[model samples]
Target: MARALQACLDGEVDEVTAQRVAVHGEGCRRCGVEITVYREIKNSLARQEVPDEAAMARLRAFGADLLTTGPAEAGDEAARLGGT
Candidate 1:
């Protein structure tokens, strides 16, 4: 499950895989802890600052694109919520 979660963070797994992980994590305490750790680590990485204003603007634009186009999983309605 940890490997599967890593695959999710690496974009190697599809949304279906992540959803499976989520379900398992909900029932299993160990997997739930691991998923929480994964999310915290990912969030920490995302908090790192870019070197310049231009780079920040580019990130903002990229996020806007996601907002407009939606998430990676097509036809998955829950995936559309909260800009996941």
Candidate 2:
């Protein structure tokens, strides 16, 4: 049976298992593409830097307030939350 490909990608597999998957990927075009694509996506995400954690939290809180309170008090909440 094939080992879990996602496990390999996530580095959850041991070295021997990883080597096996790497070999399999080499012979199989589709598997190779999937591995390459996920690796690139993970690498790209690693390079990105989020600027403001606090602002994101505030926006999330504002969204939650909108859901519970609706538009009626949204303006006041937005004003208080510093949301435009």
Candidate 3:
């Protein structure tokens, strides 16, 4: 599940993989929460107005942390931070 989410984020997962994940999300509460978190994270990032190096560095640092921890842990951290 985490793999699928990461793949989706990286644009590596095909439409079919995404669709399968969507279907699983429809039936599983946990997966649904993950998907919701994913969407909220996406939207929050899209809404950010970071127009400087500091902001970009922060984003890069976060990305590095996310990479070390993987998707589920990153999502959990985001949830803790009121991200999703």
lDDT of 1 by residue, 9-84 (tens): 6678888987888898889999888888988888767766544668789999988887877755444666566446
| Candidate 2 structure quality by residue, lDDT tens digits, 1-84 | 234778898899999999988898899988898888888998877765555677889999988988998976867888999877
State in Å the error of residue 60, model 2.
Answer: 27
Top candidate on lDDT is 2
RMSD list, candidates in order: 16.2, 9.4, 16.9
Off by over 4 Å in 2: 1-3, 50-84
The count of residue-pair clashes in candidate 1 stands at: 0
Report how far off residue 82 is in candidate 3 (Å).
43
Question: How does candidate 3 fare on TM-score?
Answer: 0.52
Off by over 4 Å in 1: 51-84
Of candidates 2 and 1, the better by lDDT: 2
- In model 3, pairs of residues that clash are none
lDDT of 2: 0.83
User: Once model 1 is optimally superposed onto the true structure by TM-score, how far is the C-alpha of residue 47 displaced, in angstroms?
Assistant: 0.3
Global lDDT scores for all candidate models: 0.77, 0.83, 0.81
Per-residue CA lDDT of model 3 for 4-81, tens digit only, reads: 875775567888887888888889999888888978888778777455678889999988987988888968889999
What's each prediction's TM-score? 0.52, 0.54, 0.52
